[model samples]
Target: MDRRKFIRNTAATSSLLTLGGLSLNSCDSPRNKHITILHTNDVHSHVDAFPNDHADFPGLGGLARRAGLVHSIRQENPNTLLFDAGDIFQGTPYFNFYGGELEFKLMSMLNYDATTIGNHDFDNGIDGLLAQMPYAKFNFLSANYDFSNTVLDGLTKPYKIYEKDGIKVGVYGLGIQLDGLVTKQLYKETVFINPFEVAIDMETKLKEVEKCDLVICLSHLGYEYNLEQKPDDLKLAKKTKHTDLIIGGHTHTFLDKPTVVTNGAGRDILVNQVGCFGVNLGRIDFYFNNETTVADGYTIKV
Candidate 1:
């Protein structure tokens, strides 16, 4: 890996690191098609950049700038899929004033493919999230969160399948437990299921049944926890098989690159998160030739 190729803050500046020692340039073939995955997590209603005088992140992050970067990437590659891990609401006055309407509308404009629900998404209650659903053109994936008896019943799907250049991709969502994190009134009647159990089911169905070429987990389970009792993305990766990648949220972890974990079947699974406040964009490119796939990843500061 070349340090000079590492990501920088300038517009569309990209750095590439080959995961699993797989080289994209050396493996190019006529049968290969590339899938570009662009993702964000814990945006928290940051519609505008931080003030230039801010101490830590001065003049950084904004939805408009993110949208421009996404648009440019899409223009360069048509087989691009954009996703969010969770916590699109809260943090700013925009959410308080508009109740996430502006956030959803802006994300829709960015053409987000899917997103998962975070605990903070229920800050104003399930109804508040439900209210902004109409403003979003994308779908919400929540495999472990049962909404059967709630107002969100039938509004969200457990998983979805997407095809890119003849390659089948399966994606699912997982949410964290809200027992102590969220109020009973906010996430009323939303049953929480075990993410590990759901991951087993989702991976089995996606790989063995659906026969997807790539299986991704859009998780709000956080990156890693100091306490081993708390299940995080690293635990999920090691416990599940047939999951190729995990895009995670919560805990606002800023990973410089993707972490590779060995699964139950001894297969490597990649997990990545790009901090919070829409400060950075996570990019992973998968190039497939025949039955083989290779990934390259980087994070661009917006």
Candidate 2:
């Protein structure tokens, strides 16, 4: 269960989205129910605050601030989901010294619902991640990385569904292609599959088989790339179907507001990515009904 629960005041901000002269935000009337999604990405082993004299970021990101923010969100909305998007390893002396033990332990203490594996996570080899798996209380969802022959095989799931207040929130993860990013020796036997195809399969099972009301993707594929390059969240949003929202990382992107895109079916799909090192906590509030009508939602800083 999610353990980072706190209590606070929640303000309601409502706006009507007209979809071809049809309203999507008001199927019934404004309701009391709500679900808040809190996420982080590319937190490259920044367990402690940056030094006071650091040039770029000073006294910024740390687990304490992030945990406090997440706790406040869960407090505001009891039904909340917290997630991390890859690169949980290899950034600071913490990972180099403790070998990811601190990462798993800290995340576990924060009550993260799930996370995906990034190429940097394979820095110590797949064995290292699996070695620290027992320290994590949450599951690591990876759909594109095939771990058939690696020590990580059969340890992770493709997706997970959570039923909170009659809301079926389905979340899955897509890792990046690690060919040039990671050393072959480190990620040995871990085959990288097509994210677009894998996303389709996971979406089908989540929407059709699992019958989730909302399907979210925890993606480590950066938000965008150079022209003609399609390995990014913006491209994934256009290429896939049934992906209601995409929370991404791996580019150290800090989006003040979430970007809205059109899906394969021409429906609204939102994409968001918070900067790395737990500097900011990404928050999106979705309020829906029995039919269509989700809006831009709201975003908050940690």
Candidate 3:
């Protein structure tokens, strides 16, 4: 079925998609490798759907719905990887009561592969974040934030490499500056590094040393900024080398399609972000062959 038609049909039903027998196999001699990436950003502790009478996104975007969607896709393609771009804390009443424990538990239940840290994740302060760290099953990656002097020193990694069905994917994380966004007491002793410098080093290490087939950045740097000095996904994509996809957050920008920009090496890289509050799920499919690799990304209304 056509992509738009499939989305339209799925949107008609409360169950969302009914993509039965969606073929992953093709007629080619050498079969293609398919990896499905399911992502969410700035979910902010929304465990339940919005009230049906609400102004925007009424009767949509609950963790249950998002889970079902992810489960269905994983069933179809077992090579699926789920990721979060951050701000997983401090939004709904769930966070207020449980203090981010519930959010980590649910993401663990959904088998999130990895996630980056957002400034809001520090709402409870460094010690508070460490207290809830044991609840998360997935690894936390942040290349730009230096936690050496903080309680989270060894708790998070700068990057992780995963091999799914013969394809090696190197994923790293970048957080926005915490100076103004987060209270100093909350993120005490955490050093904010230059994102551009970190991006260069991470890309070089991942692509050169690790020899990854793809390099993805889970960034909480927002999508783009009008100010030239501010580092956003757009600027990162253009300045970086050997990075493939940037899954972003912080601005809550709703991008129906991933934006492709040419990097410093004159190669096309993608930057994508779904709206905040778990309102949408981002899907990016990478098809790999011997000679080349290509990607197609789309957003699903959760």
TM-score of each predicted structure versus truth: 0.91, 0.88, 0.90
Where does candidate 3 stray beyond 4 Å? 1-31
Q: 67-87 in candidate 1: lDDT tens per residue? A: 899999999889999999999
Name the weakest run of 10 consecutive residues (lDDT summed) in model 2.
Answer: 1-10
The Cα local distance difference test for each model comes to 0.86, 0.79, 0.85
Clashes of 3: 0
Off by over 4 Å in 2: 1-32, 227-229, 290-292, 295-299
Please state every model's RMSD to the true fold in angstroms: 6.4, 6.2, 8.1
lDDT of 1: 0.86
Better of 2 and 3 by lDDT: 3
Top candidate by lDDT = 1
Q: Give the distance in Å from residue 20's predicted Cα in candidate 3 to where it truly belongs.
A: 29
* Candidate 2 lDDT: 0.79
